[model samples]
Target chain A: MTRAELLADDPLWLILIKAVVLLLIGPLMTMFMVIFERKVVAWMQHRPGPNRVGPWGLLQSIADAIKLPFKEQIIPTTADRKVYFLAPIVSVIPSFLAFSVIPFGPQVSIFGEQTVLQLVDLPVGALVILACSSLGVYGIVLAGWASGSAYPLLGGLRSAAQVISYEIAMGLSIVGVILYSHSLSTGDIVDAQRDGWYFYLLIPSFVIYLISMVGETNRAPFDLPEAESELVGGFHTEYSSMKFAMFFLAEYTNMVIVSMFATTLFLGGYMAPWPISLIGDNYLNTGWWPVLWFMGKTMLLLFVFVWLRGTLPRMRYDQFMRLGWKVLVPVSLVWIVVIAGIRAFRNEPNISTSQILVFGGVALLVLIAVAMLIPDKRARAEDEYLVPVTGGGHPVPPLDLEVPKPPKRRSLSEAKVARKPAAVPAGQSTSDTPDKESE
Target chain B: MSAVLAAAAAEVSTGEAIAFWVLGPVALAGALGMIFARNAVHSALWLVLTMLSLGVMYMVQQAPFLGFVQIIVYTGAVMMLFLFVLMLVGRDSSDSVVEVLRGQRLWATVLGIGIAGLIVGAVSRSLTDVPVENLQQQNAGGANVNNLGKSIFTEYLFPFELTSALLITAAMGAMVLGYLNRHEKGMKRTQKELVEARFRGEYERPSPLPGPGVFATANSVATPALLPDGSVAPESLSRLIDSTASETFSDEIKSVAGTEPGPDAHALTPSTKDTSTTDTKNTEDTEETR
Candidate 1:
């Protein structure tokens, strides 16, 4: 269908229905994803996860959802009542809004009226997703600040920095896609990918986008905000019951949004896979089948997210920030330039495949040369703290160190034989232990 | 279907009118709230609301690109930075009363009012020409993003380039401001003095409140301890519950009063009042002398 045809207005009831479906789709997908994540992670770890809830624990998320409302809702006495109450709400709204622009399939007939499977498709569909995801940060930051607690505040601050660092890369990465598609609308971008996907054409942008979307959602490896072993529960430290559940829903829903966004941009969106499309002259890419393909691609991305969460360790706050700012941002920025140049070259008359190949080769060499040029970072023994020791502590754990083991069990007389004190066991250095050891 | 859609597009929808009224006031009220909110964080949040409402208003006006950018850049990133600054500076820090630049605030007010008047005049004149109805058609819509970009880069290239230069200059100015080091009033101390100040013996890492490990009380953070040395005391105000023991915080001290030799069966005191009093007075005097 043409762009004008795609922009056709549906009946008001149909529009409302689309919105309601979009709303319901997020929570349902979140519920499914939660179970899927748990099951997959458990399988990877060799354990049975929540099987008691239902058959193979398929309905565990539902049970959790049911439990959330009945549980006692807690608002800390010291918390800023209004901000605290609004924080989770702020987080969840954008996640739901993000789902609006994600194209599920092409136009379909519903109740004798034609409408697109997606909700609204604004001109800046991809940017809307980026915008919504960016807005989600406010919820986290506010939640942390309003908690009137220490760890949550730290978590919120981390989120602020995290979002700022990753979003530039995320936006830049999308620019490459937009340059290729020559359209900002998600539907148009998907439609353009019908002949050949941008996934292969814009490989670097896709990879950067993959990393960025992970960071954007604050998922594993890049999930510094709620680094459980460090900041307690991060921004949701003071939250409990339904309010806390909202944050949980927001997180999983963002995962879905980013994954769907990736599909829309790089994975040919609702188009069937190559093997399937090749059959019957691309028959499978039509009607409700497209929705299935779109969902399948999104699901695959979600699995990748889950897989990364299961496998990789959470990144240290500084390392995560450095990766985003010093690496991903600059790389994505450079990649956009490279893509734009390539586009300009392709547009020129009489350019051969060999010339394009040579250009790609040169680009690859340049990246490699740059990589080799930058000096390797040597580990610093002194600056080992995850976060720096700043004025007025915010309750983030300092650092883990190779503390000399305590002395072996011995008689009091044997212990007393050495001049070293009981507190300073044998083979342990006094100064090596951090102040936290005193606690 | 086409006819119905065309008719719907021609007439102003109730939803559109409602959204305009709803969002316009909220955006204006958000500005007012930003100025009046007591807490710094609350003020920042109000600014966020203003930016968000404006973004919504832009979307309502059919400028999706501008609307999303407004939300993403101004509300999302810039407001976040403002909050970061507020949080970092200590959340409880209030605005200073004393105007550092004399007459600057007054000049700023006057200039702001003059600018406001100019904008109002321009908008009012435009409104008279468009009659509000044609302004809807003047939307140019989401597709205008490409047109706008093309115009700026081609037709208005010089002005756009000038704007970029101005932005670069502003950025440099900000960097320079950051680079400038302002000296504080505190006199620099020697390494030895600094070390001495930091490592205060028996009071290392003082907590802001009375909490666990201060003294061996059953209830960790609650209640102050009374010393056996005839002192109603905690030696340090710090409540940081460290592994190290206090001189007074020992299990062997028995009870503060030796009148009851319950746990250890160790310090048997005289049942008679006179003898007990003498013994306690002698111990107190000895402690004082030491």
Candidate 2:
């Protein structure tokens, strides 16, 4: 049966069940992701993680969640109480919302009722996820603003900028996928990758998206908002106990959402790996099997997130932003154009094999030439504007650049006479005479 | 109008309507308390009440998600930050309001009236155009996370991505702004200098000769003589003179001191003839007595 026929047959109760399942999956996956990340990072760093909780600390997150609500709630005196209280809710809701459109499996029979293994699907499902994630920034921003503290506000602002920058690169990176699939629907995009994953065909876009997704989620190595050394817990600095826990939960859930999106778009959502696909006609691709495969791919992507967090240090805020705008955005844009060109050529009915090879060769050459040429312009511009000044008499000091030596201090007599009284007490005479003779 | 009034009356009982009336006033009180509380910290607490009431309103509107978000984000995290900043900056209860209204009281009144008028007009217009079908269809479940997610990832993907870019830029801008550079220009000056420069301007110069020796005499008579014990006796004498001179010198010095050189002028010149005569006379008297 066609995909449409299968979708049309789904009952209201089945849809509700799928939605509930999806909702539960987000928190559950987030819990596991947290524990898994800690354990893996600990392993990488040569330490044990969370072995005290139930069964090798598998239930640590559960313990945390249980403990959170009971902890004392502190409201900052200078904070906007309404906005401050609303920020974390804004954060977690969007995370859950973003996860809803992600397809977990193919149409599966449940309680003898046929239904898609998703809460609901829309033609613009991908855009919905993006919107939710974008809306998530308001929570951080408002939290910072409401807190009325410098650190939280700074963190909030950083989070906002981080999300906005990486989001563009992230979106651009997906343009290639959208072009290839010819649909914005997550399920359709996954279905389009049946023959081959876009990760292989659109390698640059895939790589760009992968990098941008990490930055977008404010994960480790990109979590400037929560840079402990700098922001003292970022936008949630004032948050205590349950409110803080919600933010933490929201962050992990967001990570899962992004990973699932990456899996659906580029890793072929719910499709079994190559070896498994080769073993049988359709054993692993049907029923509950596909769910396992889908989950496995998402977990793997999540593991990569943990690995990055463990291994890489957080980038400086400027460096993180520069990577998004200066590198990822341009690369994604170029790749999109290249993919579009290739797709147009592929669509031609009478295209020859030799002509295709020649076109491919030319495309590769053009890409190389463009890549080689682009940096020179940037370098020249940077060289020309080498002076590190912000220009309000408060110039940004040059990064790692040596400032010219200030004119040497004049001899004592020539030094400008300070107009104010000496900082030393008036009773203590400033005469240069030594008391040694009297002594 | 009669049918509508009858329907409204039928929908809510007197008790329910009374409860609504009570809640409306309470919510308004909470909002006013949030704004007008003397202590900033108290203001935040009052705001918490306001948010809680708003959340109830959201619940009434069948927007549980929005209501939950309202409480969680606004009351929980944002207010906590506000309180934290107040504490961190040491804003005590004793801190006086620096400027209650400044010059904006009239402007504020005008703006408030304008806003109230606009809101009333809008509410009247909205009441006239209220659609029963739209109100009935409002519970269509599109506001759920699932629907929201689908919409974001599909139709609004570009704008969503663009918004992320905007947020990232804003974050970057904030980081740049918040970066506390200890060595930033103008901040390098001493605290005293900064305060003086900021408040005093150039008005606080010291007098050129500020201390005791500037106008005082350098005479040997004024100077205390060292005794055989190596102690100076003249400090006590000067203290005695200082105590007596203010009262005694006013009448006597005014008449007699006008003829003689002034104390300051006499103190400056050398007393050659008087010193020599006094010394010779002292030696002659000692020889005669012996």
Candidate 3:
């Protein structure tokens, strides 16, 4: 029987237990993720990290969990109290909800009752994750808006734009996977990858998914919305205590969700590695062992998240937007067309697999050539101004960047004279210039 | 669409009926709350509640794809853009109730009622007269999405393609409308112009403002710097911080400085006096007197 069929037969007590377990997974993952990120980042930077809390800072998240609620909750006087209180709850709920469709392992026996290790697998399970992610942005935007402050408002707007821009590319990338798997259900997609993962088959889609996922999650390198240097803690600037902790929990939980999703889609969910699968006619792929493999794959992707944070600096907002719209979106469109062409060719009995691959290669090369031939509108527009592009057609900063001149130095005698009551008029004239200039 | 609704209605479980009854009133309340909310953000949020309940209703009717798309497209993207624009322009810039166009409110009320009656009449007519098919049987193997895709591509291909073209045109129109001609607007200022303006003495303070100093009370950016004589350096406090900060410290400055200086008493800089020495001397002077 299919996984969905098995899921439908689950007893009420078993379903409740599964739901409870799924809910617990988010917080537990978040708890581990928080300390994991700090420890890994600290190791990368050659720092000791939070070792004092417990064994290699294992209990640090627990300490934080204890401390957060007791801290003072300061609601800003100007804030819309209802929305302000509602924002964090809005942020956290959908994050956990997105995890419902992420299949952990194949059908497992829980107290001798057969069930898939997932909360519920809707027919359109993949879109549920997409929907939840889309809903996630509202919390941020609302928090920023309800704060009644300029910085938070700006932060919120940036996040809205960022999520919208990246989500298109993300959805398109997922379409490639869905096309290959021929199903929108996460379980079916995983089941289809018994022989080969979609990542190897659709490299462009994989790469685009990687870039867009990072952008979608608001992680470092694309983390402009919550850029601490610019936004002063971004949307959560006004939030304090448990309210602030909720947004924190949401972010880490989102990281886990996206990582699990990427694993399920690209890395082959709950399936053992090739060598291991080969042993005893896929012995390791069966029973509870698949869960370990699934967790291992998820952790691997999570490490990539941390690795990216440790390695790359945050991108400029415009540069990030250009990457999303100009680069990723167009490439995804072309890739989708190519994939459709291949699928069409595969359906024709006369065309052999080898010949189809050759045809696909030629099509890809032709597409790349066409892409290269297209002149850049932005560059051409810049060229019209006839600004000297000194660094090989790249716009360079001005050679002689001017610095403001320093004020005329006052001697000790002049300063002493200025301090005298008689020199009050002279001091007034000197000070007046700066004040006037400032205006 | 009606076939899908008919199939869902045919099943009519007790739980499904309960959910529909509960959500119907909630959705109505949400819509009413949206109209009545004082704040624009609150209104938008209320609308979101309405949209979410509608999405849940769609799910309950065995159309998960439509439900998710409703959340993703309407509540997620469209409403977010609404909130974005509202926040960007001005959150507090609520619409004035004073009608610029006379009889606008009366006409709006009449038209709203007319539209409501028309929708109700059309829906009830369709419900009674339309032939219904079982979508559950068609989608027995959980092939609802696949079946929808097949219909869109096969039977309704031209309409689907036309809709995409319309959407692309709308996007292009938005891009064209938003495009700014920087040259025509003269919004782009060269570095040369700024530097020349500074050299021409158009600005009084050619350099950036001095950093906040080590005052006895605080050394934060909001705290104004202390000069050698313990008076506040007017240029040292950031204008942004100055406007929002409650403590101007005029009384504190008077006590610290001993004698209050004139309005423009900020010209006591000596090239020879180190800031650390001056700060220490000021502190010691205050301590000795105390």
Candidate 4:
């Protein structure tokens, strides 16, 4: 029987067990991910991470989880109390819900009943993931607005813009995968990749998805919403205790969900590697073993997430936005058109898929070269508009590239003598002398 | 997509019926809450709840593709933009008790009922006119999304293309409206102009503003800076802070004791001579304000 048919036949108690397992996976993975990320980041920087909690501070997240609820919950005086309290809950539920559609493995026998290792599989599982991630932003925006503070409000607005811009690119990237897979369901997408992964086939879409997933999860360079240096904890600036911990949990959980999602979409989901799958007539790819492979690929992506955090600095807001709208969105659009062209050509009897891909690749490269050769009008305008060395009304120092010449300094004795009216030059008034000195 | 309509037409399954019963009233309550919520932000949140429930309702109806798109487009993109604008404009930009438009509330109630009636009528007409078998025929060959795609490209092609054109126009209009002119005269002054203006004495003092609580008794913000000649420097205090030094000038001086020069005392540091000029400047400022 197909996985869906098997899933449909699950008993009430078994479904309940599946639901419970799905719920447990989010928090459990989050706990492990938190410590793992910290340890990895610490290692990258040549430092020992948390060592005091459990064996190498493994119990730290659990202790934190215990401590969070007991800590004082601070509500701002000017806060909209109802929405203020609701935001974190709103944020967390969607992150967990998104995980429900993620296929962990192929059909597995659980307590002698056959079922897919997923909580749910809708016809549009891909869109469900997108929808859930989209819904997740509301929590952030509402939290920022309800805080009744400037920083949180700014943070919320930023996140809203960030999500909206990146979501287009993200959605477009998935379209290429959906086109090849010929199905919106996550399980079907994974199944379609039996021969080869979409990541390698649709390289451009893969790269776009990789960049966008980071932006979607608010990780690393794209983490402007919670930029501590700028907005002082961004949207969660006013949240405390359990409320704050919930947001933290939601963020880490989102990280896991997106990483797993990337794995499912691009790394062949729960399928074992080529060598492992080759053994025993594809034995490792089936049942419980696939779950191990799924988790392994997910961890690899999660490590990439951590590695990015350790490597890149947080991007400037304008540059980040430009990258999303100007670079990622346009590139995704072009890539989609190219994919559509290739897909169209695949239907012709004379053309092979490989030949079409090679032709399309060459054409795209030439197009890019031509595009690059053209000078940017905006850049030329900027070059023509010379910036003044001295800061205008604002007190900005001169740009580092153009150092201003220093004013001539008088000796201390001369300065003191110049301060006296009698020692001042005959034509120069004492007031005028001070102004000259100042200039 | 027709599969969704077929599911609606068929005998109500126990699971779907249960879901409908659970979510139906929640969606109704959400709509009501959106209208009645006092705060604008709260109203937006209420609308979000309504949108979420509607998305689930679509899912429960076996149109999961439509369900997710409803969420992705409406709840995610559209309403998010709504909230983003609301946050930017003002959280409190809700309906005011004082009516700006005459009979607006009455018109709103009437128009709202009219729209609801229109919707009910339209839905009922469609249900009556369209046969379920035809919907099933449409649903025969492909998945719900594929059916949707086929219909959108073939039957609804013009409308789809029109919608895209409309969207592109809207986007272009937005771009035009938001465009910033870099070269407008008096838009931005050059650094050279600012420096020259400063040297010309057209700007305020070149020296930094004296910080609050400088050489004061309490060393708190409310305690204004004391000048070299035992006078309160008004510039040192933030307008937000209470002017405690000005109100209890003598008391504050006494509190600082001999550390501060007494008002009547003539013997003081050399800086006292320089402050005598600024002391007159302060008196002039206060007099002008008075």
Q: What's the TM-score of each model vs. the native?
A: 0.75, 0.56, 0.80, 0.78
Instruction: Name the candidate, 1 or 4, with the larger TM-score value.
Output: 4
Model 1 lDDT per residue over B240-261, tens place: 5542344335333324534332
Query: lDDT of candidate 1?
Result: 0.80
Cα deviation in Å at residue B9, candidate 4?
6.3
Against the true two-chain complex, what DockQ does each candidate achieve? 0.25, 0.03, 0.26, 0.28
Checking candidate 4 for backbone clashes, the offending pairs are: none
lDDT of 3 by residue, A95-124 (tens): 999988999999889999888998777889
**Residue ranges of candidate 2 with Cα displaced over 4 Å:** A1-8, A359-439, B1-290
Tens digits of per-residue lDDT for model 1, A1-439: 5543544567778878888999998899989998999999999999998798779888899998999878998889989999999999999999998887888998778898777887776667888888999899899999999998899999999999998989998988999988888888898899999788989988989999999999988889888889899999999989999899999999999999999999999999999999999888888877789999999999999999999999999888878888988998888887888787877888988999898898789988999999999998974537433243345633333244345667577889876786555567666655633332333
Stretches of candidate 4 exceeding 4 Å from the true structure = A351-439, B1-9, B93-117, B123-142, B188-290
In model 1, the runs with Cα more than 4 Å from the true position are A1-7, A350-439, B1-16, B129-142, B176-290
Q: How would you encode candidate 2's per-residue C-alpha lDDT over A1-439 as one tens digit per residue?
A: 5443455567767767766876787778777777888889889989999899899888998887788889999988888786678888978887888766788888788899777777655555676677667667667766776787889878876876777778788888888988888777788888999999888888898899899889878888999988999999888989998888888888888888888999998999888888898777867888889889988998899889999988898899888889989999888887788787777887898998799999789978998999988754343235543333344533343355455777676777555465234566776766543342222
RMSD of 2: 17.5
B222-277: candidate 2 lDDT, tens digit per residue: 34454434443333235544543643454454344333233453564566434443
Cα lDDT of model 4 by residue, B8-51, tens digit: 55677666688788899999999999999877767877898899
Interface RMSD of each: 14.7, 18.5, 11.3, 12.1
Q: How high is the DockQ of candidate 3?
A: 0.26
The model with the greatest DockQ is: 4
